[model samples]
Target: MAEVRDGYKITELGEIPLEWDVVQQGDISVFYNGRAYKQTEFKNSGTPIIRIQNLTGIKEPVYSDLILEEQKYANPGDLLYAWSATFGPYIWNGPRSIFHYHIWRIEINEKILDKLFYYYRLDFVSRELQGKKNGFSFVHITKSLMESHKIALPPLKEQQKIAEILSSVDTQIEQTEQLIEKTKELKKGLMQQLLTKGIGHTEFKQSELGEIPVTWGVASFEELGVFFKGKGIAKKDLSELGEPCILYGQLYTTYKEVIKEIVYRTDIKVKNPVIGYANDLLIPSSGETAIDIATSAALMVDCVLIGGDINLFRPNQSIDSRFVSFQLNSTRKEDLAKLAQGSSVYHLYAPSLSGFKILIAPLEEQQKIASILSTVDAEIASYEQEKAKYEELKKGLMQQLLTGKIRVKVDA
Candidate 1:
């Protein structure tokens, strides 16, 4: 960790390191707020327009459905940052295009620092800017504020070296993530084949749940276990402490039903809050669109599942919860589509879910299948956890290296 020195003059931030120089963002780069292009002016034929909606901090840029005239655009190398609710600075690699006013384009002058180096610098300082925002309504970054923001800079060679080191780490993380994704795709293909056609068996029979072995039987979801909807807990009742709760937003796209975020209720007033025990199956009853939510259904293990939007199915001893969860997730496409009621949003009722049928194999077979799938799931989870740790490390390094607090030597 770098030590803070007292000699530097007072500015927006208290003090700085003596060796580092303080300069406003504008002094380093040309800053411009994105221009607003009229909706009618947008056409499908021209260049894609970057929007706040398309700006994910780490992911590749997604082109918006709307496009604008080529003249109103940011160049390929310019850095883009969102001014809206979710804020982070990222390098623009997509085609040159216009963007909504909610974004800002930062074009760095080559004499000051490497553009790639500053891209990471802006990313590091963005956290401070976000913390200063007043409220959630319209958290934005003003061009004036950005221009006045101070940063430490090093020699040009050092800037390139630091950016290269951090960029290498990023590349490794990205490759690991890609590998993890490929593993998941492989598992999905394996599950589709294994669950449908048993190992070493070529024949399958037509059943209500779809094609299956002749030995398998069609069973109702109710027959597998007890089903109940989650109890309602008002937002006002939530707390930072006390009993932990899961929200619909915490669900992940992967098969692992890991809860990434939680809300707590100190009052503990709600009764039968649909608390789940290990080996319970949880399914989302409603979502923005039918089948839009990934892992909308998942198996619970060693975690208390709490959410009004989720439905809990406690399977009896005859059924393995993991196997049931896998079957539900795999077969839910058609069922969820049928239960979808609204035009804009799709929802499923508990009654409708309870009426859905499932295929029941012998208890021993269920356990065997569950065990096989669980092994694959465990591997996938390990990869995900590794990726998360790498991402956190990358973020921390970006905060330090990008600001020139830690300097690197460049060969040039």
Candidate 2:
């Protein structure tokens, strides 16, 4: 059972326990900011340099950039936190590395508290630091603010036990993520086999889409459905709550997934509006030169009614929407490149997409292919949900154990 005690309390984060002491972050740990190093001084190879961008986790640091001899350095086991753009503290787990000026290095006295325990405590208070900002703009965390931030601390032994328990949960999460990736790769291989060649003992013949079965025919997208472009809804008209809308600009890199909760436009005209019914397909007609064009197309799984910045394709009963969606997504890179236009901002126009050719099996075969792929999609979704649950469980454990509300036994 957890009993709550109070002094000056934190909002939404709850009250401190009677046995725990509430102290400034500076009292618990030492904080030092890194020095700025010139970009010209950065070398191709010397040592892995940590930067604000590289600060990801307290135990796991992702090193994407390198630095040369002329940079300030921090060693492994030191906690690094970003103070600009995004504010969250992370421990350095990489090899001997240097950091940019925007990052702060935290050194602790082990006799006072376990370093890992302080890491978890910092994680809990990260949101509080972020909440003090004025708006979406960059808010720099002052050294005084960092030092004055309060936290609940327990005895040193209990702190070590708490860190170990939380670390174990993180390990399990990482393993599960790897398993999910392997499963996805297996499904992709299966799709290539079944989709390219018909099931066992099937006849094949020459067609416009290559040597496909006699039952399969080549068809144009315009022949099967009405293709239209979405309206341009301005950013100012967006609202927190409104009808769900799909924006071509917001299409994901996977092209198969739909990202919701983007800026929504309520004042935009709703007529036709590129509203997608179940099984309807949508494609992007334009994009920047740097982006992959194929990733801008998608098929609607659920009924969504809103229109903004997407090219909608409503399939008739003659063809299966899922089949067309898969074919569009699987289009060869060279074919998409051929259709791409405009040097400044590359675009695959609606007319070009309508004219593009696709290989189509019989209606029954198309449905069967879609059914098989849908099962794989469901499995992927299940894994993602499980991953989310594990994350939430880990967060709860961190809150409890780090504060000594729940204690774990440590091996001596």
Candidate 3:
């Protein structure tokens, strides 16, 4: 029922170039199921057992003293697919390990298909098949289902070219991620020093918050701010076009240490609706956990509607709002977390927040610290955007190159 484009033909895997062949994934490769291990077989040290968690890097590797058939083991560089609760294709970069039963060791026939190309093909297929199978216990894709999956294959050389292009994009994404991590580490080190020690200070004095700069002052949070509770707006009341708003939940899910721009809006009407002021520190009054209850962000804009379950702190003229937000999120997080109380769902009240103590720097010093941290945050955001752009580029290339919608140059 679909029209075939010129120079393309209709096939079981859909329309592909005239020179390409429609092949069952199993036809060009062999799938070897790994051995399932018994509890007693696990040991303190020997051969590592690769579980689904090991492949995903969620848990540490468990070792086994028992030896099994050679087919049960996967060595470095072997392409593998985890088809259990977590589904994806992985090229093993770890030591030689016996893979669990849930994983399939794919051995490609390289004469007709390049191994790297098949790896990319399997990755594409796995992503498509993920979460679509309805009746399974937990995305339990069987080996037969994977083997029987249909795919369009181009010439071996063309496959290699497609794989090379995708791999280059992947490398860029990896490097960008590394830069993001390094910048975060730098922020952590700077916060630890700046909050406690004043810049270029030689004298130090003991305070309730440990040793601080001699000239710095200490005060309870209530001394510097007025607490107000946001009223009325609920999740269902939010809409696409209306007055800009900040919800309590967004404090944890959306905004960070500082709120730059509002993403949510609502048209709902309420009596005595609360509006946030610039430099107001926002904290979620209720959350699923104590750590979540402690999360806070400073509103940088004026006149936005503030929803329920959020506590707003309006600082005095002398204090910097970003400085207070960074201090609470970094240096004072554990202390603030302890104030949160509840058995199931935690709640942090304005009264508890008011009594919390903080070290105060001169207005000029506070602004300087905030400026340095904000610049680092901007750098991280730029790298994140670059990473996302490359990922999108790879996704588009896969859709085009894999199906021969766009062909790569090959030697005669």
Best by lDDT: 3
* Two-way lDDT contest, 1 vs 2, winner: 1
Summarize candidate 3's per-residue lDDT along 1-412 as a digit string, tens digits. 8687898998777778998999898899999998888899888899999999888876688899887889999999999988888877899999999989999998988899998898888878876775365534465888888888889999888998899999999999999999999999998998999988968889999999999998898988799979999999999999999999999989988888988899999998878988998899998999999987877898899999999999989999989889989998999998999999997999999999899998899999999988888998899889999999999999898888988889888878
List per-prediction Cα lDDT, in the order shown. 0.68, 0.67, 0.89
Q: lDDT tens digits, residues 1-412, model 2?
A: 4534442233234564455677788887777767676666666666555766566534333332544443256787777778887777777777887777788788888888787777777777776555555522356767777787777777677777788888788788887788789878866776666556655636788776567666777878777778777775544556667665565665644336333223344545565555566656676666676245654434554545434546677777767776666665554344655787777877777788788777777788878887787777778778888888889999888767765556566566
The regions of model 1 sitting more than 4 angstroms off are 1-19, 57-71, 133-137, 229-278, 284-310, 340-347, 402-412
User: How many clashes does each candidate structure show, in the order listed?
Assistant: 0, 1, 0
For model 3, the local distance difference test gives 0.89
Query: Which of candidates 1 and 3 reaches a greater TM-score?
Result: 3
Off by over 4 Å in 2: 1-15, 55-71, 133-139, 191-218, 231-275, 286-293, 296-306, 316-318, 330-334, 337-347, 400-412
Q: What order do candidates take by TM-score, descending?
A: 3, 1, 2
Could you give candidate 1's per-residue lDDT for residues 1-412 as a string of tens digits?
4445444434344344444567888888876677776667666556566887666633334344454454347777778878777677877677777777888777778986888888778777776655654622355656777787787776677777878888888887898888888888877886786666655665678976688876677888777778777766655656777776655544544234333333344456666567767666777766787665424444454445366777777778787776666765675455656666666766667687777776777777777877787777778888888889888888878766665445555575
Candidate 3 stretches with Cα past 4 Å from truth are 1-3, 35-41, 131-138
**Which consecutive 10 residues in model 2 have the weakest lDDT in total?**
254-263
Better of 1 and 3 by lDDT: 3
Worst lDDT run of 10 residues, candidate 1, spans 254-263
RMSD of each: 4.8, 5.5, 2.1
Q: What's the lDDT for residue 76 in model 3?
A: 97
